[model samples]
Target chain A: MIQAVVILFSVLAIGGALALLLTRNVLYSAFFLLLTLLGVAALFVLSSADFLAVAQIMIYVGGVLVLIVFGVMLTHKTDPLNRSNQKPNAVLTNHRAWLWPVLLAGSMFAVLFQMLRQGNFVLLNRAAKYQTTVDTIGRQLMAEYLVPFEIAGVLLLVALVGAAYLAMPERN
Target chain B: METSTILIVAALLFSIGLAVVVVKRHAIVVLMGVELMLNAANLNLVAFSQYDPDRLQGQMMTLFVLVVAAAEAAVALAIVLQVYRHYRTVQLDEVNDLNN
Candidate 1:
């Protein structure tokens, strides 16, 4: 049963990513990225990382995706000479240098697959214990991982200020 | 659901992400590709976290990664917007010049 679920989401995630690559419209690609992020979150749940799953959805789907959509909209180009191409969501890209990159990605995948095939994970011999990880994560954030946790907060604050500063309109 | 299967899926996802980043000229879409790659890594971490003694370390690391990724996405989008404002186009290939 769980195997079926895993396979289903795995297909969903990979297929969504492929669609995101194949699509030409920037908005459509952003929506497909939404599909991929959700599928990854489901995989996180299957791996017993419940907290990570929730965090993935909230941060990736909720925050990042919205930001991406806004980016797509704000940066969209409307050709004044071409009347039919002025649609805001029709931000279609025409050309890409696909030959070498696809080749490199495919070769990289082949190498990783070959490497992983030869190895075995002894850790998989044990079944994962599924439990609520929120408390453990909370305690760790306040305890053992406190330093990094504080650093993460500082980093986020800096990013927030920096992004705002960068995106602000020019005073001149 | 073998661990290898999850890892393979991640590999495929990562490869597709690489293709997207390379093949797409749109700046925001490239950002999407980067996000996909990050999620692939997160999946690997979550899969292995299942085996941790207390199951705390892996997720903890993933949590940090999530925070960093969020910061990255925000800053990246901000930069993309600035690039568009300055260059009048978001296609990475078109914005070859540093100054307008």
Candidate 2:
């Protein structure tokens, strides 16, 4: 049952990423990103990282993706009252540069795949088992990883303030 | 799920993200690609954490990564918004004022 879910969500994730790549409209890309994020969240569930899964959905899908869509809408000049001429929603680009990225990413994947096939990961991971990670994670975060956890909080606060400052329009 | 299977999925995601970042012209779309790559790393971390039952280090790292990714997206989008306001376009090729 879990295997089936893993496979399904992985497919959903890969497919959504591919769709986002192929789509020209930024709005469509944002929606496709939604699919990808949700799929990743499900994969987290299958892997038994329940808290991360919930955090992924709440933070990525509920927050960042919405902000992306809003960025798309705000940046574009769309007039709701006028219907005569709508600006292009699709992004324009040079087609010639595409071959290099495909080659680069493809070679990287090929290298990683080869490494995975040859490595001793399977043997080393023999003792690992699936279990709910939330409690363990919480205790560790409050204990061993306390400093980093507090730093993360501080980083988030700084980011919030900076983002607000950067995004706010000039009064003059 | 096999460990190798999850790793392969992460590989696919990372590559697709690289492709998106490379091929997409819009800054926002490139940011999306970056998020994809970040999630790919997070998946790998969680999968490995499943193997090491003792420390749960992988899950901890994934949490930090999530926080960082959110911070990055916020600041990046704000910069992108400001860029659009000044340059009047978001395409990577055309937004080059330094080259001109």
Candidate 3:
């Protein structure tokens, strides 16, 4: 049952990512990213990191995806007439320089897959002891991980301020 | 599903993300690719956390990663907006003022 769910979401994630990569229209790519983020969130749930899964949805899907869409809308030069005309080629791109990235990512995956498939990786049995992660995460965030947690808070504040400053319109 | 299976899926996702970052010309699309890559790393951390179970260090790191990724995305998009303002275009190849 869980395995089926994992397979389903993984397919969703990978397939959506592929679509995101191949899509020409910047708006379409942003929408596809939302699909990919949701799939990753589901994958998190399947892995029993319930807290992480929720965070993924809230942060990635809710926050980041919206920001990306806003960037797309703000940056892309839109045409009201073209909108009505609906030309198929909204944003055409040349793929002539794809060889390097394909070779780089492909070789990296091949090496990692070969290593993982060698049966040398150590994996502990977590299902027997699996429990609600929220409590554990809460405690750790307050105790052992307190410093980093605080730092992350400060970082987020800085990012918030910085984004507002950067995106603000110029003064007269 | 085996741990190896999960890892392989992550690898595939990460590679596709790399491809997107490399191939895409639009800054926003490249940002999406970076997000995909970050999610792949987060998946690996969570999967390994499942294995350890004792410290749950991987889960903690994943939380930090989520925060950092959000921060990165926010700043990156801001920069993209600024780029668009300066260049009047978002195509990375065309925004080549630094090349000369």
In terms of lDDT, the poorest run of 10 residues in model 2 chain A is A87-96
> What local distance difference test score does each model get?
0.88, 0.86, 0.83
In model 1, the Cα lDDT at residue A28 comes to 92
Tens digit of lDDT per residue, candidate 3, span A1-172?
Answer: 7668778888899889989888777778888888888888887877778999899999988898888878877786655566755455365434437789889989988987887777565453334244678988998899999999999999999999999899887786
TM-score of chain B of each: 0.94, 0.94, 0.93
lDDT of 2 by residue, A1-172 (tens): 7677788888999999999988877888898999999999988887778899999999999889998888887777644575355555443333227789999999999998898888876545575566887788889998999999999999999999999999999789
Docking class of 1: medium
Q: In DockQ, how does model 1 score against the reference complex?
A: 0.80
| Decoy 1 TM-score against native | 0.96
Model 1 agreement with the true structure over B28-93: per-residue lDDT tens digits: 888889989988888888788878846378889899999999999999999988898899998889
TM-score of each model, in listed order: 0.96, 0.92, 0.92
Q: So what's the TM-score on candidate 3?
A: 0.92
Indicate which candidate wins on TM-score. 1
Per-residue alpha-carbon lDDT of candidate 1 for residues A42-92, written as tens digits (9 for 90 to 100):
988888788889999999888999999888889876666776644553788
Error of model 1, residue A105, in angstroms: 0.7
In candidate 2, how many Å is residue B64 off?
A: 0.4
